[model samples]
Target: MTHFDVMRRLTGPLAALMVVALAGCSAGSREGDPIPAPSTSSTAPTPSTVPAVPPAPTVAPTATLPPPPLDPLTPRPSGANTPKVVNVTGTVTAGVESGCLLLEGYLLVNAPTSLVYEGVRVKATLEVRPDLVSTCQQGTPAMITSAQRL
Candidate 1:
């Protein structure tokens, strides 16, 4: 068969592929450059022929997050005359004091039953009882005197 016949068959399909590739890359072109139509005079695009499309202003991917919540470890001044009352607010996880705040269907420490589940928001009055709290958790320990779900 003649070489021209082979090239004619290949060019028809190859030109269609170029049209699709150019469409994806057209986003970076000038305001009024005419998209070249499929023709034998123009060479099929190579990687270099397609102007570099300085990738979609590569937005460094971000994660979904809430505004920073109240820190459970904020410090406050202590005076001998002042009562030790801690107003701690945080997500109450399944582990309270690292242990489930409930046992056998009973909520311990007067922790509201409705709020006993994990990840419940709580604002509670923690009475200072340093002796009963273990310092290993990197925070002070106190009894839950009262709590309100926020």
Candidate 2:
């Protein structure tokens, strides 16, 4: 036979063998599916001696998270609508609450008035009301309704 004819004869048998092998390999490519095998007896196969597989779990998983933390402890009054009061010494300066009171070491407290000079030093007993909207240097507001020079 010619060289081309010899190659053709081999190709037919090789192609058939490849198709059969591919068919066998594809039988078990899917997950959770049994691979088929040749069986001789017509009777059903006996159960394996291996232990039985337990059923899949039915309960769903749960996620638990801790409660959010509490807010910072603020200086609150004994009752509602009660104003915070304090007595501090500082130089008079302009502030949002009006004439701002500047303590030697403390943050500025609003004292808003022209009667006190820009840099006058004084010791004052002041009644500071709780201001929800005032933005002084400190977190609180001090309204010095009464004052006396030291």
Candidate 3:
């Protein structure tokens, strides 16, 4: 080839190589800013381009309950004091101390004289102190200060 043809060919390939190299260098930088270095900090913040993770869930609240009521006339079975007159309804289970009849039937009655009676069905308005009613169970024998069979 001639000198002019050789020079043209050389210049064309050199210009193309320079353009490719310049394109790669420019890609590493923003419009006017420098490229950032790799982070070394253990807690380095993530780039804003990435999405953030969400937080965990929580539990709801609850309510509480109240206390029970009190009764006065019902005597503790283990105690010595003879119970006052109280009307009860239960089957005749056994005979208790004193003249108590130990009603084993549906209704039970406790008289002031330490007498207890068991009946299949007993309806008696016993003269029981209001304070002792809370301790009485459905079938518990109570001291019947005054009782009238219904």
Q: Which candidate number maximizes TM-score?
A: 2
Local lDDT at 102 for model 2 = 50
Candidate ranking under lDDT, highest first, comes to 2, 1, 3
Model 3 TM-score, 2 decimals: 0.22
Of the two candidates 1 and 3, the one with more favorable TM-score, higher being better, is 1
**CA lDDT, every model vs. true structure:** 0.56, 0.57, 0.47
Going through the candidates in order, what is the number of backbone clashes in each?
0, 5, 27
Index of the highest-lDDT prediction: 2
Estimate, for each residue in 1-150, the C-alpha lDDT of model 2 and write its tens digit: 899999999999999999999997877545544754555576754577556889998986687775343222354445644555578777765444454445543333434355455577777766554343344554354455556665
lDDT of 1 by residue, 7-99 (tens): 999999999999989986866555565875445585769888788767566576598775443233443346433446656766665434455
Q: Candidate 1 has which clashing residue pairs, if any? A: none
Using all chains and alpha carbons, the TM-scores for the candidates as numbered come to: 0.31, 0.32, 0.22
> Which stretches in model 1 have alpha-carbon errors above 4 Å?
1-83, 96-112, 133-139
Candidates, ranked, TM-score: 2, 1, 3
Better lDDT candidate (1, 3): 1
